[model samples]
Target: MADFKLTYATMFNPPEELHAGFDKAVEKLKKNMGQEYTMLIDGKEVKADEKFDDHSPVNTDWVLAKMQKGNSKHAQDALTAARKAFPMWSHTPWQKRVELLRKAASLIEERIFDLGAAMALEVGKNRMESLGDVQETADLIYYSCYQMEKNDGYIVEMGKDPLVGYDARNVSVLRPYGVWLVVSPFNFPFALTGGPAGAALVAGNTLVIKPATDTAWIVRLLVDCFRDAGIPDGVVNFVTGPGSTLGQALVDSSEVDGVTFTGSFDVGMKMFQDFGKRNYVRPIILELGGKNPVVVSKNADLERATIGIIRSAFGLQGQKCSAASRVLVEDSVYDDLVGRLKETASKLVIGDPTDRNTYNGPVVNKSSYNDFKDFCEEINQGGGKFLVGGNVKTGGMFDKGYYCESTFVVDLPFSHRLWKHEMFLPITTIGRVKNMDEAMSIANDVNYGLTAGFYGSPEETEWFFDKIEAGVTYANRPQGATTGAWPGFQPFGGWKGSGSSGKNAGGHYYLPLYMHEQIRTLVK
Candidate 1:
């Protein structure tokens, strides 16, 4: 019945309605209810003095009551809890743990809508987009179950080495670190969190999720969903705070055996540095900032390419770590491509996110919009012509929520800093490259190498594929038109500045982060 503002400055409070079916079920199962939002430490709730508001970015719709703003004290609490729980969790029978993960996945499937609503309100995504996030998260949950169960070492087998008569060993067994600190970003909060937590839980690691302060309600909802699946307390916990304090706690905590982060490069690198301060470096998997580039080949399809480029770069208001900020087109097709891009970009309705028809919603807040706007100005000052959109205003009828023109610009070099740094908003820079080599040269020039796409013939695709340097590369496509980050395969993390290790999210390789592998030998 009540509405709230969605921005960074607001405070999040848990309200009564949060318990509709979500809370009642927890109580029916005799789950503890109405505990002060606290650090989940050693499988228990410990209170915190600080709290922040979880808001709706779409409008000034103030949703949830105060979200717990975590501090070093809270981080210590969760780390302690994870430490105590880790020994048992790490050694927990992997098969049994796998079943628990399946339960978690099922719980998500049943309560998708409840979580979806929280996502829609908190993060400013529309109904369907929120659902997509939830579904992506749930798919990851289900995959985590199989990932652990079907892992090489989960089932025993025999093998022989060339020098040894009979050498037999399972590939590797998964073990939980005593503690893991998870820092999740605002975009795709559910899917992002679910990927790691599902694997960690299956591998018997306890998780302390520091979800984005903006979407704490979704985090709260996710915690309850896991609880519904009979996950024990402290196995999965919540902490809402600025990344600085909490992230430092994890990096410095002796008990925190590992950490997984999905956010900007600067923050991820800071954590990596902190992790290095100790002798035994905790595992740190960072899915960081991306300056993804889309290369439109001379022979590519413009109409489809336009739609794909818009969706790829601007979807989710261009707030994703993998958002395509740079658009490199072959000069032969550059004019037509830029014109079509501007035409389609102009049609995107940037306004109140609640309206389903609104394609591009506001950025997370004014700071993001201002940064994007300033970036556009800087580009314009550099002599780039604004083909369409790109004008932004603050402090008017719409003051708090952030929104940018579905901006399109041309004449900027592909190597411009505007394309180099990640701008968590919907702005595209269309650059013209003279030939295939020029396109490849410009595309691979950025420091951050997350994902890139090439639209051309099979030979040109092969040529670019061989030359372009990136973690995730696509061919004959406009960039982000496909689903699940990759076709059939979910979005993989990138390398260079893009990702810490460049491991794909949904593939079988994700388990190695939480679980350390060792091969033992018996000789006679």
Candidate 2:
């Protein structure tokens, strides 16, 4: 497939030529906005009786696209389609499956610019982050393919049993679940959608992907990539609708064999609970929300910690589940760390996401905007100091977009609701700790344990890694404190209440979860 090798988007210090191309691509997509899209079940487009308007989080005045409002019936239809295609697809040779997925990855690379443009507009992600999300999706698919090849299609011959000395043979094979339902989140929609979906397909399972309401168009692009690569009809289906109607239908179905979900803790946990009510146990892979933390020890380098904390706390407008929402600093470095962090936060550029220089973008929608405003107000009322930003930005482009300042607050107690909850906004709470021990205590005190970061010396860093209760951890990383996880480099997952499955996505253990083991004994 044209000598494909997956590489992440190089946004920093990128050649001027790349920027020129991206700018043109954005213009092209902007002109094509407002088209209507429908559900894809069994290779046909099925329009729903109801439709929803998708507006740009960057500029709500601009209609990005129209999506079919999928319902229970649509979910059932998609499931039926998947089941219908399962026999042939599951029997397809693993080598053939690998080739088709690789072709899809190549197709995604060919259309990377276009997809990135759509993502930036639809998700309010800056150019770099949007492009990274698209590239990461392609990488994730390639990784899954690589894993399939490495494992020899998960078909292995086993040793003969001691009692089977009379000419007996044993073999093990992993077989796909009947139908896999993929429910993706808005942030990193392309990657999260493609990653889990790829894992399922590579393992021979059929998929009925339910894209987030806001990101249906992006998923449409992804489905096209798979279809163009020659995946059989009904093997990969796409449906869009509200969670109350479509989501509930998919989860309630006893026919669905497995599900991969990425979203809020409340919803993910509920799905985990409901999936268990069936007559038999059904596999559910979930990456839920996180109230991640970053600890700056007394031995930390203040400059490094400040920059890392800023990036983690505000990147993607701090919408990432792995974003650092709480920062616990040792008392010795607390003043310096807070001072530098506020300075960096104040200097960060906030504007249109398509701009190459923009460091922050708008929140996903009006609800998030209101939540950010209310959180900042509460912090102020609780006598916390707003060392940098505490208000939303309005007027001009901000009038239509859900724009807000990347905020920082101090003097909030560890028991504050803001400290313990996941705001999913560009807000970070800073508190002082007596030492590394107390910092660890405060960091792990939250219910969620998705991701965490530490800035300290080698000894302290080792201790942090040993003691931290997160699934994903980073130390002294300038790119971010808890953010910036590349697929192959860091397999992402969560611990405690942040996730239902212990296996990390894009890691070695992920694909096995999509299938169940079948042991065969042949006596000769």
What would the per-residue lDDT of candidate 2 be over residues 1-524, giving only the tens digit for each residue? 13333333134555665577679899999888999988899989899999999999898889999999988999999999999999999999989999999999999988888998999899989887887898899989999999999999988999987673577789999999889999999998999999999999999999999988888899999999999999999999999999998999999998799999999989898999999999999899999889998999888888888878888899899999988899999898898888898788889999899998898989999899999889998898877888778899988888979889998989987777888989999988999989888889888888888999999999888899999999999999877899877777889999999887898988889889999999999887
**Model 1, residue 330: C-alpha shift (Å):** 1.3
| lDDT: worst 10-residue window of model 1 | 5-14
Off by over 4 Å in 2: 1-10
Clashing pairs in 2: none
Q: On a 0 to 100 scale, what is the lDDT of residue 42 in model 2?
A: 94
Winning model by lDDT: 2
Q: What lDDT would candidate 1 get against the real structure?
A: 0.69
Candidate 1 has what TM-score?
0.87
Q: Would you estimate the TM-scores of all the predictions?
A: 0.87, 0.97
Candidate 2 lDDT score relative to the true structure: 0.89
